[model samples]
Target: MQKIDYREWGVDTLFYWKLLIGLGIIVALGGLSALYMEHEGHWVTGMTNLVVWGTPHMFAVFLVVAASGALNIASIGSVFGKKEYKPLARLSGLLAITLLVGGLLVLVLDLGRPDRLLVALFNNNFKSIFAWNIYLYSGFMVIVAAYLFTMMERKANFISRPVGILAFTWRLILTTGTGSIFGFMVSRQAFDSAILAPMFIVMSFAYGLAIYLLVLMFTFAQDNRVIGDNLIKRLKNLLGLFILGMLFFTAVYHLTKLYGTKYHGVEYFFLVDGGIYTLTFWLGHILVGMLLPLALMFCPRFSPSRMALAIACGLVVIGGLATMYTIIIGGQVYQLEMFPGMTVINEGYGTEVAKYAKYCPTVPEFLLGIGGMGVALLATTIGIRVLKFLPETLADESVS
Candidate 1:
């Protein structure tokens, strides 16, 4: 067997360097936004007592889920024994770390007291899912890094399969944990479901692949490298399949909710009458996010065009965000059913059972979320330039 030659991106063009610098500035802006929010407190943002987790959580969770999903390429090679995907493993591992770091950073910085991160880490509660997530997230970093080492270090290659399997299993548990965070919320009519664990897993597949394809395309385009049509076709087909799975879960989720007479009101609120929430769910997630992307990728005319694939990938990402917004923010906006039938009101929340709270995201919150993306991109950009993360070429002849 011939060993694959790993090479740095080695992009020395002025344009390449400028792009990295520009992304760095964006990261800096995001940091400044975080500082402002921390100084003024959570009150400065759109978050209120009623809607505690807002836009930042949406973005953070997306990045986190996508991060694990991004490992599909590596998992395909190591766990599933797909030889074609083996070359992409290093970049896959790299993305998992950087994207998760970006996500966890946004989540951590959103804390009213960002300084208390150590306390959050040290003060562990085994009963709390969030506490388990902290360990999962931290452990993921260590284990995945070791997994990457098994790929990077030739002598350690013997352990790659075992480490890969471990990493793959760990991410499943991590994503399931993340999903249960919402699924376990029995008080909220929107969340309480056993289906969410597998649903999130499927979602991670679509969102992760979309982001991976985006990054793969962009990076390859940047270096003027050729990606094999065969490989990309497989990726696009996989993406389409995962998306269909997402739609299946989305449908089943609503169908299951619609089945219960009590859940009808909650379903109506999100599906028909929640105004922006309804539009976002139907138009943004279902129409633009799912349908349009599927059309772009599967359509005979445009499917062959790389640009069409890119657009589909971009739309999928937008849809993923829209879905999260509906799930996280919109879910919170609707009042939790403390008393199922009675219209209970409290001093803390002066509203009826069906009343929805208003929460508009502030600029700082947006930047903070974007900064997490910056952190991910910045890490990837720097890592590729410095290390042998990218293959010299992915042309069928070269890779084969």
Candidate 2:
């Protein structure tokens, strides 16, 4: 293997700007949705007193967690000293930051008081893990930017590895903090476990890599760059491993819930008869997200084509979102047991005892959530244009 030559994706065409503008407009519409929600109050949105988080949380958390995973390619090159992955490192860093920014924007926009975001920073609650996440999220962005600089600048070559190492470690902590946001919730039976932190960590790897591969395939194929089959094969194997890991953790989580006799009802709600939760977990997350992608990855019949790799990547991403929906929204849909072993009377939560709560996000919520994705895509398009983040070619000989 040779030292990979990194180069800008020098596609200077009017169509490129049109694409960026188009994405920006979508993000703008999302902004309008957020404003409408704020004006009419959450009464206009799908978020209720019980299901306060809504679809925005699912989208935001997915993007944020995926952001950490997106940096893995860069880490493989910079930290693990893998020459084959080096050419992809810069774009990895750029995607990580952009995806994170996009996710965070959705989160902030969905807040009850977006203007008081500064209050969250200054007027802090030291006891609240949610508050601490504010810093951890910001810190992640800063560290990643620095990490990107170290990669881009020849003057910083001496410290790139160290910076990469730091960014890698920082993102782990960031994702842990994110997962803890739910794990620390004592009131929710679905969330009160130490397992969530590691679950998110592992899920991040799969989600992040899935997004990375999709972006890589598109950019290279669009510009007619030589993305070697060898590199695609290696990344595909890693993606499969992460997808399988997500499945394992999900099983363990539900199984643990089932182990607790008190949580039998909850287990049944999620695992057996929870309707949408069950469908998402079994059909979307497991069958579509995990199994099908794994089949695509390992089956020799599909191994040689980049198109196959792209299809596998798309399935993994879908699975990632499905997994998020089940975990975040499904967990909430299964009502919290106000009193165990006793039928709750006069609960005033719009639900009788042992009954799950129903929530469906409105049009505004959907637009806002999708808008976050648009932001990440738009930022990536712009970043690649101005920066030498992509390599000109990845011919098997050059990258192997």
What's the residue-level lDDT of 2 in candidate 2? 77
What is the per-residue lDDT of model 2 for residues 333-352, given as tens digits with 9 covering 90 to 100? 88878777677565575455
lDDT of each: 0.89, 0.86
- Candidates in order, TM-scores: namely 0.96, 0.96
User: Could you give candidate 1's per-residue lDDT for residues 61-134 as a string of tens digits?
Assistant: 99999999998789999999988889999999999999999999999999888898899878989889899999
The per-prediction tally of clashing pairs is 0, 0
What are the root-mean-square deviations of the candidates from the true structure over C-alphas?
Answer: 1.7, 1.6
Model 2 ranges off by over 4 Å? 349-354
